[model samples]
Target: MKDSEADSRSHKPCVPFGRIAVLGAGSWGTALASILARNGHDVRLWARRPALAEAINKTGMNGDYLADVPLPESLTATASIAEALADVDAVLMVTPSSTLRAMCEAIKPHLPDAAPIALACKGVERGTGYLLSEVVTDALPGHPVGCVSGPTFAREAALDHPTAATVAFPFSYEDRLNPEKSPAARLAMSLSGGGFRPYVSDDLVGVEVGGAVKNVIAIACGMMSGAGFAENTRAALITRGIDEMKLLAQALGGKRETVTGLSGAGDLTLTCSSTTSRNMSLGFQLGQGTARAACFEGRPVVVEGEVNSVSVTELAARVGVSMPICETVNAVLHDGADLRAAFTALWARPIEAEPYALELSLAHPSPNLPLQFGDT
Candidate 1:
């Protein structure tokens, strides 16, 4: 269906929920809160600083993060978690991955048991290597948990540009029986409106993995761009990056097709090709000979790829997945490997057939077959 038609159909004047607490007043969080408010929901946005909350409440704008877009009057800001969660029907956790656990712990006491939690953040937990969905489930057990992700930039989304995303929530037996009444369906409905379309799925792991791994891949693409590589090189990285994403997703028990879906291929293309992405921009700086410290010295926003590179590489090793691109990014960013040298090494690696072709060859060996790297 056309996006405009979908937007009109999905937002046919349904009664909005009672209240939604959007924890985290960053660009992404504020944008999402604005969408909910625009959809006629009462959205309470939580900011870390009381001053920022006061400013947003007074001016109806998140000047620090989203200076250009004016937030809806229905969307209010607060610094107190208790006030935000007081009578909330749902919660959207949009904080950084590294601090998600602490945020969940802080909200547990105030959160309603019946309220579902939807994660808008990307990336796995830093030390535990847990996907954001897993982290939420672990910290806030008994609450229905899901995630919303796709190729979306906060500014565009806040401005009401056409946007679509995957809203994934693993259904329980009961949820499957009453699909319409399920948390997944409700969350999808609540989040869809104002030129924003959300497609539903049951692949929670696939969604989270795609969202996390794509950031790492975007950094690699940015590095190639910074190093003066052409479109051909960037194309190659994106193609191979999908393979890496699929391998890791499957190793972690997610569907391979999910890696090729909106949260994966769609997101990868947008982030890797755009400097608006924090991860890609950070990689570009590194590629231009800027020190990691210098790149991040005065930056207010967190560059998720720099942080996820370490956890993603570790997770790949633990799952025995071969993600050379992600590993190289981790090496360059965290281990201080020389950027040009790393790219040189990557290019110097032995040539191999595409993954599917190699699989086919493995299933049917022949004397005339080209020798592969591991062939005896």
Candidate 2:
């Protein structure tokens, strides 16, 4: 609620799109669908399961992910991928990282050419180590792609809590939602309202990296907290976590300052500090002496950091970017490294007088301007 249209997007004419297709009926998708519908957009939620779609349509709530949160009455759902995509002006891809490629493929044949899409998934490809945009661009080439990421939790968003995100595109708040408006502008206008704000940026890679790395760091924070480590330890992890994230982003050719913007700094602050985070919760359980199998046994939830730890470490290694915190998280998650040992190893590294000092550009420290994504 803090980010009014005037507060985030610069003055630009905009018009609302009529029909929006939201792929993925999970908590995040449903929450966003409700937000858009509440703003008077005709929105359809695409569910993989027919029963889930029927349940949402009948009860106006997602039985699996969001039991108590009420959804907008006009919000609809369908199991047919083509039906969901038919005549829709925009697409909101909200599936998890594991299913992103499949979801993209499923929707590809149904999507109109040059249709605008905004992805909600985070993390690198499990084996390919490609960003979500990269994967999507390969699947839906020539369709203008963008993304939104920040400190938004599905439950909080459903509760109408204030949530702001970083988005990319050539459109602006000044762009009237005309038929000719850019995909970024239409997607932003479609999702804006009800305490949800979007801060536009062209650094989609930076935003994606920020979302991916923070989950890994949040796991470390949870481990430290569960093990009864002091706040100082958690602070150290978060501080170093951002430093490594910035390094990785820069190595990938993203602007250096993207690491400090909404996706990077804001998202890290939210994920690393929250005890309720899925990744943090898993780490806390591990730190509390629970076995990995016990922690995830029978749980259907997806932990972005669990996989991102591997992908990010591999990415950093390939580019020779030293990501000690990320590497340590991957170790604890996969290599059975002791949590305390990883922390100790991190501390043992030679201390630098100014670790974060770099030749960062002063032109734009944040994506508050109208820079277009994929336009470097």
Candidate 3:
């Protein structure tokens, strides 16, 4: 196909974006890199360990994550942050939530002043209780940051299965100084691979909170499955899960509509129904005869819901949103409450109205204008 024809086919308004960096070598990062490379962008997958980078370069695969999934030849793996970020237009960060702050700090000196970042992590920070975007903006102030979230599983996405996600910009992406360049628009184009649909949203909080909290609810569902409960039990957990997710999102200044969109309801459904979910799997083992220590002893992947249970519960409490399911999960996980006892406590709570009521106010948007990023 002609270059112009290819560009048109790819749905991008402009020419190719040079050297896009994915700042993590985990399953999600590797998968995203493969998609971007197939779209004809120069893509780099960053690994902290040099051996992992070398392995990917030599084997044409990421055995640790993708398990023999063939990677695109156009994708390159690198250990050097400078090598990945230098001359890059945009970056997608799939790092663990705990490491996001540190990773951004390390990438800051090498990052272009106006480079937009799209974070794929799905957990809030521990202790301080910051969302992924809050962590990003705090570390890289003045930079444009967005989030990619929904029901996407990295393995499915890598296999080119049909998948969809939300691309959220908390701040405006179009430059006030130069109206022609919108980094979010360009980044969305670069991320849309075959069978992967990217929908745009301005509800960053709703998108992110949905992504972060669904895993917690999924764990509760897993316990139901593992304990030999029927589908009615699972359905109830999912129903209550959405209610809490919406309440938490709105309490944090996000809209109700965004909470009900792809990132919220879609992701919750996917996570709750499948044992493929890391958090659900972990919860399954817990609900069965296995101990928590035994369940996670040799697990290689991060069970984000395990972490989010604590953070989300805390965030809701501080913000005055009631989430009994999340609180029950937290108690079971951390406070050593017996699984049966935890369930009983939740079951015995005083019943309220069908939906919760709360006074929610959105944060005043940042006064910063869009920063120039991609080629004009």
Candidate 4:
């Protein structure tokens, strides 16, 4: 085929959904809304700030969030929640982890029946220790929920950089793995398109655990990087981080290999290394001995890993998981533990096999594991 023909074929529209609503106007949310628009879906974005909505509607740009990129002319920005939710095919929830539950409750009354809800945020709820999806399920019962998670950084995913994420739910039976036999599986496959390729997996526990815990690990890697550690040290932190991730995921019924896949290791590598990652960047400053205020650089946004570390460590204790690395991170960030001391403590710990001292807890049914996320 000619190059032009190939280009045309690639851009050919997927089956259209009538309207799609994105609930947040942050960088990731705007980027995803743009992707849906580029894929030939009508999209509406709801921003809490009227000024942002007006700028996007009038200038055809969202310079603050998605800097220097022109938005699709067809994309609508609305300040009112009702206007955005009207006749939407799917609702993309991109709010912060801390506020996700309240955000869902606010939007629940306006959601269309049977509309698929996709989560674009990652983190464990602080007080409840519930994964983000658990909050969604509690708020919107019977909704076909789906999650989009991977190593995607917003700037890259927004720029149409090649990225892949998984769309998963609870696997009830083995027969569903056969694409020909399972409608849910088929439906999951049907939704993969544009720049976001979706892998279907039955291991929702693995997916969520990998997504949540990786952020905490990214912070640890950042601390090492900030302290002028060499690449070899960085790699060790990442490998050990995966060890903890596997233990936590397996405790919650996740497959061990899932932690080795893109959502786990791939995400850990990207977030830990990139200055764009809020968690890593924050850690870099802390390593440099900068005050917390200056480290924030006056941004009002929250770095999830900073607060999430405390909660995750607390929950890990309940399961008898010895997360020394995560506990060390918690100590430095909150307890004023010496950074060198924390790092040294991890190195000095007695050696054992992977998941040592933690495997025994998974022997019983533990509620810390998220039972199921929505279907793709």
Candidate 5:
């Protein structure tokens, strides 16, 4: 195999934690567990079903969702949520954005000693449109919260396909991990394998915003592609997508750089263009004029963007940001706006000189200067 391919097989190591818990048993959750085990760490995958846990432990594989690839032999599974959390040094929460609060509440008594909690899920809360990081922080007071996201697809990660991601968390003012010296930072530094690369940032808010909003934009791209629209139109949608994402990220006190990095622009590019993405696939079907219920037939996989569309629209209105693309998506999906009519409505809006990036900062509460991404 080539060097990149070899790297994909099992990357290097900064160091390994004693134990880590992955709360969800879905495809993405399973893939992350496999990655950790491949890098020589102890990983505990918690599922709600005893049968599923037994299948993984006995067969050394996930029988569903992630059946496309065999799970690492070293990976373990458990049905008890506490059993998974006990003795763990870190927690990787991979549950759906909507279910995050309840899951954390259930595991509240079991939370270990300030272990870093990494969020791998993306989406705005339905009623409040809160980002995953915000929800985690609010639910688990004083805990070290972080998030990881980008153009990652679970099947590709399993296959060791070349991919890049971003890891963002508030830098501890006291126990800050020196990207140069701290073992945890170094371990995270070496976490990327093969075609997988992970970039570390201190901009938790920015990373969260990028991950959450990209799904919404992917739906728009899917619709355009499904409708056989030209590249020029898709380009317009993507540009507007970035603008809307930037507007919200700024509103939520995120750094501008975070939205421009791997997790932001990079992720947007991949999810919007790929037919493989569930969000894009759903949009494509919608654009092709398929009824929502008919196109979603038997596909239970979470597209994330479908649900985020309305939340994003509401957020834009609250912040007073103009997001034509997001508005169009919300109209089509929720307000029963005709697909073609919605698209046309966006074009019908007035055009003006592009707003300066600073306008976004003016739209929300000014945020503190970011420490990590600023100089790096």
Candidate 6:
């Protein structure tokens, strides 16, 4: 096992005693709520549907999302946003990115003034092209905002399988050095224990970008897999996909190392390789000649990649970054471009030097002009 993975699995019981409100009782939200409850925090999971909330409250199970996994008896469910947010020490926003702003607005009246808010949802806002953290910050100004992201699958995490995530906040250098003194660290402590580990970071932008962009890349990898491509093809797509992620992250004022860390490369690797991922599964279905409408005909859960492909691509374009894979995914999913033709065109583009090498050359241009050298 990797040292990081091993470190994440080591038992560390530093959970702060408090009440945590987890908004959006979907699969991911429910799983996270379960983790907090198991760690001895008083966790309340909020479901939009009153019936779902009632069911979970009575039966200790979320039938719609996590039908098989039984929730902790200590955990409770509520349909009222006010009830969930009342007197909570911390809040975790796990709703879909498309609806994150509305959720934030709903909780504005009830959210505790000093309670820290952490986003577990992954996607760039559709119409605004804003990061999820940005939406939260806009909605709840003056509150400490952070995000938790990584390669965690909800079911595995709920079942106590070892899972590690990066918990990030916009910390100053001093705050980064003394993470334990910040709200982000307190939030991270709440998420730690019971085999679920969280590493604290100050690169909030990088963590958010990594979590959001990986879904788009996962869709590309899924399309390749569903279209009968071999491992070599998937490997190539993943490697190039990291380049696109790093470029986008760096362009957005995030560190490149953060992109290469858990939230970026780690999340991409897991999402691309697993059909359990909603984004990957959707892409696989599309690649297998299924109509996009047919793919979502019965599925009730939100497929982030389908939505993020558009926003991520648009954001990249606005920043003048080239992200062909994300652009191709967007075209196929939303712009009515043929899947096979898109892949073909993507692969047929003129080969250039690696992105890193290109970046190096751009940063340090040659002093002598070609004409000057020839004249000399």
**Candidate 4 per-residue lDDT over residues 184-272, each given as its tens digit:** 34333443455666576667778877888888888888887777775887788889889888888887668889988887888888888
Please write out the lDDT profile of model 5 over residues 213-271, one tens digit for every residue. 88888998888788777688778877878877888888878887788888888889888
How many backbone clashes does every candidate have?
A: 0, 12, 0, 1, 4, 0
User: For model 4, what is the alpha-carbon lDDT of residue 110?
Assistant: 88
The C-alpha stretches of model 5 lying farther than 4 A from their native spots are: 1-16, 175-187, 355-376
Cα deviation at 265, candidate 5, in Å, is 0.9
TM-score of each: 0.90, 0.88, 0.88, 0.85, 0.86, 0.90
List the lowest-lDDT window of 10 residues for candidate 3: 367-376
Worst 10 residues of 2 by lDDT: 367-376
How would you encode candidate 3's per-residue C-alpha lDDT over 1-376 as one tens digit per residue?
8888877874425333567999999898998898888888899899989999999999999988897699998789999999999898888999988788899889989999878888988888888889989999999997888888888888899888898888888545344343224564566667786988888777889999999889999999887677667588789988888889889899999987887888999998998888888888888878775887788666655788988899999999889998989888888888988776677556655545564355454333532333221221
Candidate 3 similarity to native, TM-score: 0.88
Q: For model 1, where is the 10-residue window of minimal lDDT?
A: 367-376
lDDT of 5 at 147: 77
C-alpha RMSD of each candidate structure in angstroms: 5.9, 9.3, 11.2, 9.0, 9.3, 8.0
Please write out the lDDT profile of model 6 over residues 184-242, one tens digit for every residue: 78888888888899998889999999999899989888887877776887898889988
Please tell me which predicted candidate would have the highest lDDT against the true structure: 6
Q: Residue 210: error of model 1 in Å?
A: 0.5
Off by over 4 Å in 2: 1-10, 170-180, 296-298, 356-376
